[model samples]
Target: DAGVTQSPTHLIKTRGQQVTLRCSPKSGHDTVSWYQQALGQGPQFIFQYYEEEERQRGNFPDRFSGHQFPNYSSELNVNALLLGDSALYLCASSLGLADNEQFFGPGTRLTVL
Candidate 1:
């Protein structure tokens, strides 16, 4: 089975521009979560999607939004990017069960220039 995967491995953007990153969850999973990891900080949850709906969210601004498709793949869209938004965007997948363990993919390194 294919594990989680992300696109573009790396990205460069200017302040005020927008970027969209994509992710494909592991097979048989129904939940996808987006996380932002700063240079020296742990991953911070942005939001989670399950059943084509946002099931949980974090304290991030409205600029961060996401969507999950029927196949459980997802896309993260950030608007009005700021310098602070430059970080590693990680996509994680998990089954919607109580003992689910999230599996991460190689993140997309977003650079806000």
Candidate 2:
């Protein structure tokens, strides 16, 4: 089965611009978690979605927003992007909210120019 699929492998935007990224979960997984990985830093938890609701969120600013659909697909939107917002956006899928096994998708590189 497909693990996960992400759109726009690479994107470039200037400050104050908005960007939206999408991710599709693997088969049979209902929980989707979004993460941001910056240069030389480990992935940071951006947010998580289960059953179409945000179950948890990280210490990100209000400019970051996202949603999960009934089909377990998710989209993340960042408004007024900053240079610091440039990072690799990724998504992980799990069977349930508490599931330990998470399969991660490839990262989508975002560059703020």
Winning candidate number (lDDT): 2
User: Candidate 1, overall lDDT?
Assistant: 0.93
Tens digits of lDDT, candidate 2, 1-113: 88898888999999999999999999999999999999999999999999899999999988999999889999999999999999999999999999999899997999999
In candidate 1, what are the lDDT values of residues 1-113, reduced to their tens digit?
Answer: 99999997999999999999999998888899999999999999999999899988999999999998888899999999999999999999999935369999999999999
Q: How much is 77 displaced in model 2, in angstroms?
A: 0.4
Which window of ten consecutive residues has the lowest lDDT sum in model 2?
Answer: 1-10
Candidate 1 — which residues are off by over 4 angstroms? none
Instruction: Give the Cα lDDT of each candidate.
Output: 0.93, 0.95
Candidate 1, poorest ten consecutive residues by summed lDDT: 92-101
Give the clash count for each candidate: 0, 0
Regions of model 2 farther than 4 Å from truth = none
- Give lDDT: candidate 1, residue 112: 99
